[model samples]
Target: MAETRIRIGIHQEVRHPYITHNLVGVTFSSLQVIHSPPTKMAETRIRIGILGCANIARKVSRAMLLSPNTTISAIGSRSLEKAIAFASENHFPESTKKYGSYEAVLDDPDVDAVYVPLPTSLHLRWAVLAAEKKKHVLLEKPVALDVGELDRILEACESSGVQFMDATMWMHHPRTAKMKEVLSDPHRFGQLKSVHSTFSYVGEGDFLQNDIRVNPSLDSLGVLGDAGWYSIRAILWAYDYELPKTVTAIGDPEYNESGVILSCGASLNWKENGKVATFYCSFYTNLTMDITVLGTKGSLRVHDFVIPFNENVGPFYAVANSRWKELSLGCEPEPSEFKITTVLPQEALMVQEFGRLVQGINGGEAKPEKKWPTISRKTQAVIDAVVASIKNGFKPVEVVY
Candidate 1:
């Protein structure tokens, strides 16, 4: 058997008023053994194009550069000058192409995949178009305004035989995989009892009034689609994408004058197993991102689940068979904290994973992976159910898969 090893280098330089300048470099490597000989080795890197100049695209652009299996092939915007400026600001390679319109990027034969960071309303149109052009689609989260729209995008990808995956970076984090391993262990975690998640941030002044998230025509679902997406995804992931039987809006959701949701909460129930999940999302609260899962024998808690406070390391807490001390003053077994460190950030891992799948398809070794799009549909279905419940006077709405 032949062995293949990949090494990634991460460099960091810090300068502070109280301390002298410092420089640090770290190298991380992964090794895989292949039974096939060297003659069977195929190209692995996937060329990626960007469809918009959204702020979030900046982070993904960096990820594409950092990922060993991906590269920034091109960037497109409505205005040619804007695309040029974005490329320059992001320090894109001189060979990276710039187009005046997204269609041009999609038309480029060299582009094997595209990262769509367009608004939620435009997802159905642009994402479908990208797929129809036979370009793999890496879409931003809050995939669509509703399941119907998401279905259209998914159908296009399926018909075109292009891979489709929503950009949920945290799901690719090493810590997330570690946590899932613990949850799947029957002796350690037991049956799931309940899960609670919250993702919120205070947005005032211009953000509440002028941000695209609060605009009715832009991101109509607003915070529910923005911040709430992560919370809902966490619950679904913890339960392994099992669709809940019923979804009910917890209370009256606060909305802007244009009826854009600003803050909201929902409860999901699995009647068959008596499992319940609750989540709260807001654009009008102190910044907080948390997920707490309680099982019969163990509990797991993670803060900064969406975006880790420190990019290099992700931390989570877990405890099994914890017992109260005498007079309930303290606990007998303290919760243990686990940290997973990575040379690349979570977003880079996401791009690397996406690239691996695309490379497999390009090599004719496999078909497009369906796992990502399947989970994406399940998440959007729950979001749709919650929205229906909120519209129906906070009544319980059945989640009809």
Candidate 2:
């Protein structure tokens, strides 16, 4: 095979999924930055109040600062001192308020929106309350433990006419849009056939022993919520948010002593289109985040779908309509790599999008985008089906809308 007909991908600088690593907001790689086209910034920046001092907040706080249409107005933790320290350590503006209780931040009239990165158990309570308080909600993924809980949050936001968007950062990345465009093209990518995703990371020392993700009291969903959520979201995104007809737990899932899931896999069947999807998520495996989608004409593969190794550029490989060479030594038209560059990390883009939605609502210019909550509900619904299948000894559980 000719060298030009060979395919390869370069991956580097993988980081711990939970811990903070990349801090520089300006540059991503040695490659020159390719900026997005200029656009008008919102006239009014949304004031954001963060709930809890979770480690994830450290990265998101920086994102809010980088977003031109959003600002962190307050941060709250169980301990006022911790909140204050978090504010100081994260370099929040001096005027950003620190609250001892999450409710206090919700009560603050100045805060236009709240970013809820609290544990899964607390999402329903805090997210609903934020909506009732007229504060827009930017919720973390696994929006709720199940569809029932998610419905309540969505209902509250609908009742109050407040915007609700889950913090699935990768969905906001430019690369995601590019991939969607490719998959939607009938010529380049024919009918979608299958999607397989794997998201796992090694949890060393304190994480496995004390992390809320493994604690049933705080995050009963465990790795299913922490890492699996991303994989599930990716699968659903590739399927264009269509709910699977049935879901079956594929392998023997692992659980901690507390009965929290540590590792799991499931296969989903779409009856109408005859499409199938499978995903694996684990906390005990080597670091890997991959998503592969196959179609009649082409396939797309992304190694770092959950969190791109680089902050600025996201890369995916694709191959379409290939044929064997004369001697069948190798195929013609090797896979091509596509890179989408961004001025800010995907998290910052999420914050900016949320802020823009809130700004439009406040100005009476646009209504909330129902697509966000709709997709979130569908994701949780499939998760519920997967759990049920596992409990039923790997039986096929029908996904109820």
- For candidate 2, give the lDDT: 0.85
The Cα RMSD in angstroms, rounded to one decimal, for candidate 1 relative to the true structure is: 7.3
lDDT of 1 by residue, 341-384 (tens): 77789999899889878877777777889999999999999889
Find the 10 residues in a row with the least total lDDT in model 2: 1-10
Candidate 2 clashes: the total is 0
Tell me the TM-score of model 2.
0.89
| Winning model by TM-score | 1
TM-score for every candidate vs. truth? Answer: 0.90, 0.89
Q: How many residue pairs clash in each candidate?
A: 0, 0
RMSD of each: 7.3, 10.4
Give, for candidate 1, the lowest lDDT window spanning 10 residues. Answer: 15-24
